[model samples]
Target: MSGSRIDFRKAKFLISAPDIAHLDEHLPGDVGVEIAFAGRSNAGKSSALNQLTEQKGLARTSKTPGRTQLINVFELDEHRRLVDLPGYGFAKVPLTLKKKWQQALGQYLQERSCLSGVVVLMDIRHPLKDLDMQMIEWAVESDIPVLALLTKADKLAQSARMKMVNEVRKHLADFGDAVKVEPFSSLKGIGKSKVLGILDEWCKPQWLMDTLEQAEEE
Candidate 1:
C-alpha cells in the first residue's frame, strides 16, 4: 500500500494462544503491529488466512465447524504479525466456553493497542449475517478498520460474485470508509495480492518504512 510492499509470503507461524496473555509472552515486551482475522465459525476464515500467508495448513482448515478455538498468530518479522481469532456462532461449544471467548474477543478488540486492523471473513453466499455484522461493528466501534474478505468466491458464478461485493459494501456504507469488502477464495487463490497489499500497509511501521525507502534509494 502506497510505495511500501512487505511480502506476505515471508510470513511464518508465531504461536497459538487461547487468550491475549498467552500471545503477549511471544511478543517483545507487548509491542508490535498486528492484523487480526475475525468471523463466524464456518466462514472459512482460517482458509483465507492460510491463503493470505501462502502457507497451507498454517491456520488449520476443518470439516467440523468451530474447530479453531485458539488465537493463532503468524509472524512476518519481529515487529509485524497476523492474528487468527476464535470463530464465533458455534453451537457445539459449551455455553460457558462461548462466553469466555466472547469476553476475551471483546477485550482484545478494545484494549490491545498493537492491533492495527482486522480482516472480517464471511462466506460469499451468506455474506454479513448477524454475527458478521457484529464483528465488523466491534472493530468500527474500536476505531479499527476492517477488510471484509468474502471467502469461497469460487463457489459463486462471476455475476453473483460482483453482486455480493456490492451488496456487502452497500450495507457497510453507513460506516463510511472504515470497512471494505472483497471477493476471496482460498482454494482457488483468488484475491491473494489485494489482501497482501492491505496487510503490507498494516505491517509497516515508521522505522520499517525508513528501511524500505533507504533500500529503494540504493
Candidate 2:
C-alpha cells in the first residue's frame, strides 16, 4: 500500500445509526477500519467532509448548528469507512435529546474497536472549547490518533491562521505524536491535500494492508 492513496471521491453513504446498538446491528462486529469526524455544532465538519471527498453534498451542511443528530457512516471501500459523529455542545436542543446524543456518542467512541482515528474539527476562531478538549483527551486516552482540524481558516489571514494552528499545536503538545493540528478552509481548499495524506496513511494500517494484499492474491 506504499504508493496507493485512497480515492476519497469514491466515498458513498453507507448508513446512519442513531446509537451504537444500531450501528452494530448494521455494521456488525465492527470488523473494519473507521475514521471519525467530530466537532462542535458550528465547526464546519460537514463542509470539510464534502470538500475532502470532492462531493458537494456528501455530508449535509446546514446554516443551523446541531442539525446532524445521528451517526452517519460513509464507505470508502469494503474495509474502510468515514464516520460522522453527532455534533456536540449545541445549546438549543432539548436536554433529553442532548443527553441521548451524548450517551450515543460516548458509547460509540468507547466501544468501537475498529475506529482507527478521530478528526476533531473546530472553528479556527474558537479552536478548543471544553467539549473539544474532552473529545481529544478521550481519544488520546484510548490510544487513538487525533487530527485537530482548525476549520474555517479562510476567515482569517494567513499569518493569523498559522498562529492559531501553532497555538493549538502548543496546547496539545503534551499528547506528543498522537495528536496533529492543521488549519483548514473548505471554501479555499486549504490544507485539503495534507489532511487527505494523513487520512490515507491512517487507512493503511499494517493489518488492513495485509488483508488487502491477501484479497488481491486470492
lDDT scores in order:
0.83, 0.93
**Which whole-number lDDT from 0 to 100 does residue 141 have in model 1?**
88
Give the poorly placed runs of model 2, Cα more than 4 Å off.
Answer: none
Best-matching candidate per lDDT: 2
**Candidate 1, 1-218: lDDT as tens digits:** 25546777788887887887877787675576889888888889877877777778777889997876888888887778888888888878889999988876776777788888899889899888888888889889888888999999999999989998998889899999888788999889888888877778777756656776787789
Residue 141's lDDT in candidate 2: 96
Q: Report, for all candidates in order, the number of backbone clashes.
A: 0, 0
Q: Which ten residues in a row have the lowest lDDT in candidate 2?
A: 23-32
Specify the highest-TM-score model's number.
2
- Residue 206's lDDT in candidate 1: 66
> What is every candidate's alpha-carbon RMSD to the true fold?
2.7, 1.0
Report the backbone clash tally of model 2. 0
